[model samples]
Target chain A: MKTLADLKKIREKAQEEMKLRGGNVRIKIVVGMGTSGIAMGAREVMKTFLEEISNRNLTDVLVTQTGEKGLSSMEPVVDLIEDGKPKVTYGNMTSDKVKKVVVEHIVNGRVVSDYVVATGN
Target chain B: MSLKRIDLLICCGSGCVSSGALKIKERFHEVLQEKGLVNEINIIETGCMGPCDYGPVMVIYPEGIFYKKVTPEDVEEIVSDHFIKGRPVARLMLQDEEEKTFSTQKEVPFYQKQVKVALANCGYIDPESIDEYIATGGYEALGTVLTTMSPQDAIEVIKKSGLRGRGGGGFPTYLKWQMVHDNQAEEKYIICNGDEGDPGAFMDRSLLEGDPHRILEGMMISAFAMGATSGFFYIRAEYPLAIKRIKHAIAQAKELGLMGRSIFGSKFSFDAEVRTGAGAFVCGEETALINSIEGQRGNPTPKPPYPAVQGLWGKPTVVNNVETYGNIPTIFLKGADWFASMGTETSKGTKVFALTGDIRNTGLVEVPMGITLREMIFDVGGGMSGGHKFKAVQLGGPSGGCLTTQHLDVPVDYESLKERGAMMGSGGVIVMNDEKCMVNVAKFFMDFCVDESCGKCSPCRIGLKQMLDILTRIDSGYGKEGDIEELQRLGEAISKLSLCGLGQSAPNPVLSTIRFFREEYESHIRDKSCATKVCLDLMHFHIDKNRCIGCSLCAKKCPVSCISGSRDEKYTINQLPCVKCGNCMDVCPVKAVTKVPGMHPEVAAKRLAETKLSHNYDE
Candidate 1:
């Protein structure tokens, strides 16, 4: 039902959103939802993420899913990104960790040092 | 000033998830927020990056830094050091064992030699998002084809590329396109054969799941070239995630007017649908696949009319495997010369392989054609798993043959592999170490072929079953002197008379193994011995009294209770009760139990000498 103009409008709107969201937010959370991760319960991790973010009223974090990186043994991986900092990846995430991540890391001004897989330090 | 955005990629593939990648993500979020830098960076979960051994891997972009063996506990150091202070943590970075220095992913030997083409978009894009796909230039090929190139022109480009099919047959892809193009059919069909049935292969499934739009775009380009109005994706039902992603891609394409009638405002109109296969291995064969699509029994018919001439409801059809279709858009976009420059003289473009078995890096890899098997098996595959001595490698699935250590330097192209008694059958490179028994490897592949034969023709059905029976008998220490000769004769007969590819190439494993390791077969037949100790029947369990700790672990753990002795004394294996199940060998902490050939040592040595003499004679 969409005409050429409508398609163009949609594209323009998408571009606008990209621009607005592009440089504004500093943190990106990448969730591993590849077949292996999904099979190993990545869905529950993602659900807990959405729930925690919504409940805590945090607006700065952006989440997305990606493919497996060939470690089929340890899945349900998550990568955290902050501006001017090297990316930190964490493995074996659970719902409890999701809540802790949101409240302790996103809300407070401290990195939860215990759960880090790799830190720039 | 606003914080600059950073990209973090986490491996979510099946292997890493089982190792707990999800919990790590949650912990990452907590650490990021606690630092009050949640808005400064971005985390993205991605697909398999192919180094499966040290998995739950994470890679950072702009720098392409690779980290291995990530656990939930290491997140904060990653945040504090890498994310906040702009430094990489050396402990987590993959290290070159010999050099003892942290290496970037590209610098690592395992990834340095790999030329990823079909796997190009695997870890880069968000597979589930249509917009992300569009952003990465997904359907741009279809648009270019529709807007500028004619159907004939598209076919010409494919022919110019000299791209042989990746789906085992090694047929020229453009020739197939040209035949379908020239065929006089009002309604033609394009079929994507995604029924990847090989045991160690998963490249096709990963492609569909990670980049479904690429295949869709390739098919759309092909449809435009061949005047085909409808296409079908004949994928197996085993890949549920791949299926779901493909279905989503199709819907998204249609919504963009890239699939339905008058695509991109051009007269070209094409649509696609999915058809699930019932997990039949034989259905991977083209004719058998055609039969399955037609709602008939999944058995192959003799080729002459060929699918291009007459196929899929008696209409002209072009059936291309998933990998071949995956290459189309890239070929068109990059130009034929660009692609043709990478590989050897005859076989142009890179080939994707599922490198598995006794290799340290057991996952998907794509390398340029004409790369030596040695390079692939050792450099890119990370050598044998657990540092085992490399013995042989099985290229091309069950229908393929074993390549010994002598032929390790053979260039992995269609012609070279074929000349070396193997085919590039969908690029399944399963490395085997010294512990693997050649006789057992042959038997294993033969057994698979027999089980999956579809019983359509006698050569494949009866011949394969009979050959397997002989092999089983030989491996079980029951072969007579002439069993090797009989095996060769039977294998040649089956190769000659088989109705389709399944029957025709079913004897390849047996023939190639015999050709390369005839001595091993002779040892099995003449001396009733298994050199690799893999054949249980040909081996006898013996206790090494010197190494025996007099612990009851071996006797207690033995399923057959073949060992009998007092706790203070060395155990003795009752030859009658020993099933050769190897339970005693596996359970013994002191490594007291061992498998010795039942044949006399002199007889075993003479058989080995005869094998060497025969090999030289054949050469």
Candidate 2:
């Protein structure tokens, strides 16, 4: 804080901490948290994705929650979105399925097509 | 460690805080905790988002959804639906006059044309946190100036930037810095003039409260550029929140060694103290402000030994407005040419305007210089409120003139506004509607000037009083034939002979109204009428018998029992007992009650007939 180097260091650290508030990111994971989705364990699935992302220190990936995807049968749904890549929607997601999706799709840039229910956008 | 998903930036500015923003923030924390999503959703209390008409505003980031007028009760729904469920509340979004809803802050028409140079970090970052400010590139300019640029080099950059004093005078900022720097004083001082006393003006207050560090950074940069060792922030006592935040910013900067001895580990050192003015409008003038800060009476002394040469206990001082300081950091960070490329030929950079009165968006807006009054009022301001037509706009404050509809297209640069009889005095633009009487408007500002006059000089002390008396007479319908001419004469004298800016511009509202709306004053003198019915003495309450349905609503609602007659005969206003409160006019169910301008209906009719249609009733 006393020098230019110190100020730049703090700014860089703060920029990292504030990265979630920024709009541009490499990957976005959307978890359905509507009344029906939450009742079907979507909250646990969202929490799992959050913990996995944080543990990996993936600054480029953002895990968020959404209301409904209009697919009640696939209540615990998760959408993987990356710029220039087609959106991948995984249906009936469980807490155990989050790490595999994060490792393969988020880290390795490969979709877990087994859990994928639909893909578009 | 859970990855945060949403950032709910709730506005905790003074306006929103008064409108229960704190309670809503508390409710958000409670609801997020109840939903066990507290770690995932970050609720940050940010500064003023400008459009205060939609106070208790919250902007959800990542999606950039802006929710306005959010209540404590709405917080739970916002957290559940938007935070967890990710469905933004449509009803809480910003709705325009056409009922068109804008979901994002970027899409709102109020912010469309506004270029935020001074207010860039106002609504975006946390004002209390030095880290948030630094992350947004706050003190980098000060650091850069201290490490690399010499005083002359930094001053040259500012000079090339074309920065002027935003405190209404439009003085060259670099000239003041250079003058202060050139003076061979050991203890030169930099002062931030935060005593914004203009009615409906909170641009300075918002800048101080929202981005205290930016203003501090600005002051420090100027202090560095001018070789100033000490500085003072002369904020008005009316803005307690601004005072607290600025003090907090000073403490944080000192703690981090961004201020005090050898700032940023350089040879230059600077420190600033926050001084609160006693809410005297005259103290906003530079000399008067320096007097108040130096423990003397807030009376202005004569110029020639200006503050740059002899100021703040007889040392070289550079006093700048809050917005002026707010722009200094950006000029260095973004480079001078970038700053100079934005504004007009003479006036450069953006000017922050506190838009109030009949405008739809009653808040702060930072627009580039040379933006037309029509764009400011109609486009950025969202036009006149309550379906009213724009009559005139009172620019500056009590010291500024009124520009009518004819001047709407005039570019609002410093020289352009001065040419149109109004100086950009602190950028307080009070928009008036057609219902507002021009004479009453002038009288309002004149009364303000008369009350705020420091009484040190005769022209300001006695002349403004005489002008106020004339305006009062005109407003109360006792205006005479030669009164307008006398007012113009006194106004010119006051402008030429007054001691400070206060007295010099005291007669502006009166003189400008006389200049533009001369016919309105003539009507008040000759016909004894107020076209807008604002002069209660000239307008009489009349009940149209044809429209009266004998409902007795007006009679019952009349506070003074002025309206008589029962349901059988239909009600009529007893003009003798009527106090002209217009209660009957408001309460009339059948539109029976109306204001008949100038004397009684019969007398007006008789005068009209006797004049043989010689007089023009067309306004």
Per-model C-alpha RMSD? 10.9, 4.1
Q: How do the residues B1-619 of candidate 1 rate in per-residue lDDT, one tens digit apiece?
A: 1222356778776567668878888889999999875865667666677777778887775456788889999999888666644456788977666757554666767778988777777766657766656555566677777778899999999988989888999999989989999987898999999999887888898889877888888888988899899999999999887888899999987886767988778888888999999999999988889999999999998888799988999999999988888888888778999999989989999999989899888877889999999999889887877768999889998989889889988998999999989999998888899989999999999988888999978778888988999999899766888888898999999899988888889899999999999999998887788878888877777899888889888889888877888767779987765667788889899888878875544445666688799999999
Indicate the residue-level lDDT of B135 in model 2.
Answer: 90
The residue pairs that clash in candidate 2, if any, are: A67-B85
- Which portions of model 2 show Cα errors greater than 4 Å? B97-99, B551-553, B556-559, B601-619
Error of 1 at B434 (Å): 0.9
Worst 10 residues of 2 chain B by lDDT: B610-619
TM-score: model 2 vs. ground truth: 0.95
Q: What is the TM-score of each candidate against the true structure?
A: 0.80, 0.95
Each prediction's fraction of true contacts recovered: 0.00, 0.70
If you assessed candidate 1 against the hidden native complex, which CAPRI class would it receive? incorrect
Model 2, position B299: C-alpha lDDT score = 96
* Top candidate (DockQ): 2
Chain B of candidate 2 vs. true chain B, TM: 0.95
